[model samples]
Target: MQQIYLDNASTTFPKPQAVADAVYQYITHAGTNISRGTCATTTEDLVFATREQLCRFFGGEDSKNVVFTKNITESLNIIIKGLLHSGDHVLVTAMEHNAVMRPLQQIGTELTTDNAPTDAITFSRIPCDADGALRLDALPQLVRPNTKAIIMTHASNVCGTLQPLAAIGSFCQKHNLKFIVDSAQSAGVVPINMQEMHIDALAFTGHKGLLAPQGIGGFVLLESMIDEITPLIVGGTGSLSHTEHPPRFMPDKFEAGTLNLPGIAGLHASLSWLQQQGIDKIRTHELTLTQQFLDGLQQSEAQNLLRIVGKRNCRERIGVVSISTDITDIAELAFILADRYAIATRVGLHCAPNAHKTLETYPTGTLRFSFGWHNTAEEVNIALQALKEVLAHGL
Candidate 1:
């Protein structure tokens, strides 16, 4: 059976040929550890070139401000752990993944803005509408005297609802609060400009929308935030070998130890591919596929059996569509789709239990079918037919 993979939100598959070729070329021909070897020209040049590519891709003003890590989780850790002090207050949406919530829980007292929080280190969860759109009007009331930053995901990984970043950035500007975005779901599919969005920092993964391999992700920070954020990981940066302490430079301050050259090479190539295709084109393709799937669900008889988790309109979301059903075990349904129908999907909280709770699907997760740039309308139709069959089977 021909398999249909629809889990792009987790990680994009069938990466561009150039991306795989770049990774293979690095691993086979130029496998030197950057900043450590005596002959580091090739490795250093490739790494820096990848950095430049990412800088332009994210609309970062300075190339040196791009700091790479293992993934978006690590990037968020670096930002949250490095920037938040003992008494700093934070604002986050109800749709945050564990990447943002776990770190904040570790260092700050997280609370919901609907209720009053104590004067100690505090963080508030902003509410979202039934359609998963954030209640931006509540932001002004949510702000406290000690609120230091607003950390939010650009789009919900569970339901794919696109947040109003520009308006939130304006709110942050007015409140004199830092705007830190987690772009794991929107980096490549959505256009993000740091300067235009007034973003202080952005954390992103290369594996998902960027269409690169895993094990490589990074953050973009403005020049002003360089001094404010402390280094989470401190070690040799190849620049200050003589010094015992970690370097205080832009990228070096956050990036420590050996870099993921192979993964970076893949990302470099993927950036080139994205540049050639243009982000708008890729976004339109994905959105069109999403609309096709949504329309199919609405028209199909299985529509009564499945309830879409977020906004019905495709324009309000990315390519992620999560559906919850009256069936008790959605995981079993997912297994039947995979084992019998050869249709792959993600079924669970999607690492965002908070989002599921906000959507009122807690304790039971949705069957998420996320699309990609390469996914076709025909695949969506096949999945829809498969879903109808599953429902006919009394599931």
Candidate 2:
């Protein structure tokens, strides 16, 4: 039986040929640690060049502002921990993944000079509508005099609901609050202009939309915010050789230890491919597939039994669709779809319990089918047919 993989939101599979070739080529020929050598024409230069490529890909104001991390989770942690102090207030949406929630939970109320809690670090969550789109009108009321930042995800991984980022960014700029975007789901799939969007920082993963291998993700900070935040890790930045103190600048200030050269090389190639193909074209193709999936789901006999999550309109979303059945176990249904129909999907809370709770799909969760550039209309039809069969057989 032919197999179909629809889990791009979790991590894209069958990465682009350029991504594989670049990783293999780097490992075979230029396998060397970066920033430890003084030679002008060394592996370090190649690695740094890859970083430059990433910086350019994201429309970064300065290439030095790009700091490589293990993944978006690590990058989010770096920014959340480095920027938030004891009394600073943070505003986040109800749809954030644990990557943002867990860190904020650990920091508690305040930053203090004596390492004692001074004031509680207050946080308010902007609620989302039933369709999973953030209620931006409520945001202004949530902003306090002490509001330091507003952090939110660009799109919901579970439901593919795109947020109104430009409007929110404008609000942040008008309020003088930092706007940090978690672009794990949108970085490579959507077009982002940091300057025009008024984004202070952006966290992104490489494996998903960038078509790179796993283990390489990063964050881009605005040049103006570099001095305001400190490095989360303090050791071996290679810039401060004389002292144990971390460098007080971009990239080196945040990036410590050896970088992920292999992953970066792959990402560099993936980015090159995206630049060549044009992100607008890729987005249009993915949206077309999404529309096909949505239309199929709507017209199917299983529509009455299945509840689609998030907004029904494709224009306000990306290439993901999540559905929950009224009377069937989502996990069991997913397993059957995989075992019998050769259709792979993710069935769970998708690491955002709060989001599921907001959507009222918690505990039972939902079966998520995320699309990619390579998925075909026939595969989407197959998926819908399989779902109808599963509901008929199981429910």
Q: Tell me, by TM-score, which candidate is best.
A: 1
lDDT string for model 2 (52-94, tens) is 8777777778887888898999999889888888688889998
lDDT for model 1, on a 0 to 1 scale? 0.89
Q: Rate the local accuracy (lDDT) of all candidates.
A: 0.89, 0.85
Check candidate 1 and list the clashing pairs.
none
TM of each candidate vs. truth: 0.97, 0.95
Model 1 reaches what TM-score against the true structure? 0.97
TM-score of 2: 0.95
- Each model's Cα RMSD: 1.6, 3.2
205: Cα error in model 2, Å: 0.7
Over the stretch 34-106, how does candidate 1's per-residue lDDT look in tens digits?
8888888898898888889888887888999999999999999989998988668899999999999998888
